[model samples]
Target: MSRFVVTERAVINAPVEQVWEVISRTDRYAEWVDSAIEVTDHHGIATVGKTYAERNRTLGPLQTRSVWTVTEIDPMKRRVDTGVGFAPLQDVTNIFEFERTKGSDGGTRR
Candidate 1:
């Protein structure tokens, strides 16, 4: 098997606080994540050692269930989680980082 890492960055048109408010809730992923079909189980908050389960979309007309455990969190800054059940891709780690910035209009951006 091969190992690789994928990184993505986006400048959200919102403050870090606003973004964190949504992302900090593990149960809300299905609302925004395209691949997340539904949150099967979650505590409604993100905290180290907490776990959540989700039904996810895999490929064309394919789906799978995954369970994830929160590993690290930096309040309003970063979060990391490790997951299993997305077969052929073991030890999947998901990381989210937020940075506050000023938009072109001088408004908050994240």
Candidate 2:
């Protein structure tokens, strides 16, 4: 098997606090995540050791149910989670980091 790492960076036109407010909620994945069909189970908050489940889109017309557990968090700065059930992929880890841009207009780089 081979290992791979994917990194994506984007500047969001919102304050870091605002971005964290949305991303810190596990139940809000479906609202912003394009591949998320629905969040099946969650406590609505992100906390270490907490788990959530989601119905996600896979290949065309295919869907997979995945369970994820929050592994780490740094208040309004960063978050990490690990998941399984997407077959052909195992123990996938996702990291989300937010940084406030140095500008007169408050924005977030994530």
Candidate 3:
């Protein structure tokens, strides 16, 4: 088996719910996700069993398309997706998490 891990962290200047709203919409992934090239078909809001077809840029000029299913979702907390067609990876999964940050003014930072 071959496995790899990629980690990215950022402080999005928005509230937790606001960020969740954007990430929950599978159809909008390609609009913000740098690696996603295009979404060919997105049924509806992300939910278990909901699937979407996406074209992703793996490395440089190499690209691949895959059908991803929403395997797990925790409302405004976490989301997990899994799919095949990633070649040597055979099975692949992606997880998205959101955390509320408190601002000095007693408001949510992001």
**Which digits, one per residue and each the tens of the lDDT, describe model 3 over residues 1-110?**
65788777777777777788888898999989887899889976998998998888887799988789999999877889998776446678888877776664322322
TM-scores for all predictions: 0.91, 0.96, 0.87
Identify the runs in model 1 with alpha carbons over 4 angstroms from their true place: 103-110
TM match of model 2 to true structure: 0.96
Task: Flag the better candidate by lDDT, 1 or 3.
Answer: 1
| Predicted structure 2: lDDT | 0.92
Instruction: Answer with 2 or 3, whichever has the higher lDDT.
Output: 2
Instruction: List, in order, the clash count of every candidate structure.
Output: 0, 0, 0
lDDT of 1 at 24: 90
Tens-digit per-residue lDDT, 1-110, candidate 2? 78889999999999999999999999999999887999999988898999999999989999999999999999989899999998768888999999999987898998
Best by TM-score: 2
User: What residue runs in model 3 are displaced by over 4 Å at the alpha carbon?
Assistant: 105-110
So what's the TM-score on candidate 1?
0.91
Lowest lDDT 10-residue stretch of candidate 1: 101-110
TM-score of 3: 0.87
